[model samples]
Target: MSGPAVRFDAVGLKLGGVEILRDVNLSVAGGAIHCLIGPNGGGKTSLVRCLLGQMPHTGNIEVDWGENRTIGYVPQFLDFDKALPVTVSDFMAMVCQKRRPAFLGLNKSNRRLSDAALDRVGLNGKRKSKLGSLSGGERQRVLFAQALIPSPALLVLDEPMTSMDEVGAAVFVNIIRELAADGV
Candidate 1:
């Protein structure tokens, strides 16, 4: 299957009787970066949420490549449970079309793929560590690894750089560029 260029035609969204966005049309061609900048409550996140179908919206979203495309997402903020028990390896394993981790049943190939994804996100060394032990930046990278681990054709990140430092943002930007370049 080929990757699709995302298109939004006259999309409109409303929530709790409040009209958040309307007539928002955007055509996102594949293999390019599209930036959305606006004020607080200016519907930037609303627009993104509409594209993600997290909320119902009017109009259309067309993928020009004409294939069943998979989407991976990371939210703007992740206040995870302090008692969460998953490790980095466990998170990466979720992207392999399994929907859930296999616990102790993964084969050699799956393990290799999970390893690669962790390495790509700079979290290889933390694979066996608890997710709660990671620093904020490291935790963000782990989230990135999980989202990108599947090598999905399209990645949608809402405020992906929200909590990162300058150096962390630079590193993540490079990773995003590389993923886009590799057609992930």
Candidate 2:
């Protein structure tokens, strides 16, 4: 599905009595990709949070979705207990499953989707492994895998390549190209 154009009009944000963003404006067309670059402590993440409705900001951030508004996000970081015994498959099941509990195992449809997404990120073989045992790169791949399950109309990624190796980066780039071509 083609995503909607996102428009940010005179957006401004403040937190703790400090201005984090000021009159920022941007527009991204549907089926297109946009990148935000800046140094540390810049307002990029804050702007994204505003767009996701996780933060309150001034001005307007609009996503003109026409009809469908399914959004997928791959965050820059995920924190969890390293000692937890959750397997990668368990993690996927937990996030994507609704009707059935993750511990009860993935239902048939979710199993197929999770498998394909994991394979796309080269994590199919690692599904049975504990999530804590994987390196940072592998964990990032897992996060990417989860974002692909529902085939979102709009995909938001923040520093998705942070810990990825060369091979993993190539895989990610390829998937992104494919998704864009398919009007993601």
TM-score of predicted structure 2: 0.96
Each model's TM-score, in the order given? 0.85, 0.96
For candidate 1, the C-alpha RMSD (Å) to the true structure equals 2.5
lDDT (CA) for every model shown?
0.75, 0.90
lDDT of 2 by residue, 7-121 (tens): 9999999999999999999998999878999998998889888988989999999998867688888888779998999999999999899878899989888999999999999
Candidate 2: which stretches are off by over 4 Å? none
Evaluate residue 38 in candidate 2 and report its C-alpha lDDT on the 0 to 100 scale.
100
- Give each model's clash number: 0, 0
lDDT of 1 by residue, 1-184 (tens): 3356888899988899899988888888776666888888899888878777788988987766545467777777668785788776665565564644556534578778777767876678898887788777777877777777566778888788876778668878998888677664
Best by TM-score: 2
